[model samples]
Target: MTTDDKLVYMANQIARNFEALGHDHAVAATEDHMLSFWDPRMKARILALAVERADALGPVAAAALERLRAGVVPRPQTGATRFAAVDESGASDAG
Candidate 1:
């Protein structure tokens, strides 16, 4: 997938987890995650995607991004990918 699409997918995955906390909390958590883990260039890229193709994002992710764009910059943190690891034959380790 293109990096932009990957960003969207990643954000949606984050949302799926953060959503358990509730919508407002999910938005806050997502914003916190992006601000903390994503570098400026990555943030800018996703922000650009958020503006240019919001519909491409999942519902919670889109909402979270909107909250981020509206102003909620948190400090940066070390990043870790949420994508599942694939085994030799390409099956996700999740299964």
Candidate 2:
């Protein structure tokens, strides 16, 4: 699959999992977060990981994305920011 196709496929798979978990709004919200805040590269990473481990990571990923949207700052992990701007679009200040 092309990169764009892979990303979209992963995003949709994650969304389906979230929806099954009664997190449809969260899915939509997370997608908005990705689109607005994530750079193309970050989006690619998120999607790649989502596709590779969607069965295991989808719920956690959704929760993390929701926390991000809710203005909860992620703590640095091992001296690295848990979440980075996916692209130049940057994170939204409004929560």
Best by TM-score: 1
Predicted structure 1, TM vs. truth: 0.71
Off by over 4 Å in 2: 1-22, 60-95
For candidate 2, the per-residue lDDT at 39 reads: 84
Q: lDDT of all predictions, in order shown?
A: 0.77, 0.54
TM-score of each: 0.71, 0.38
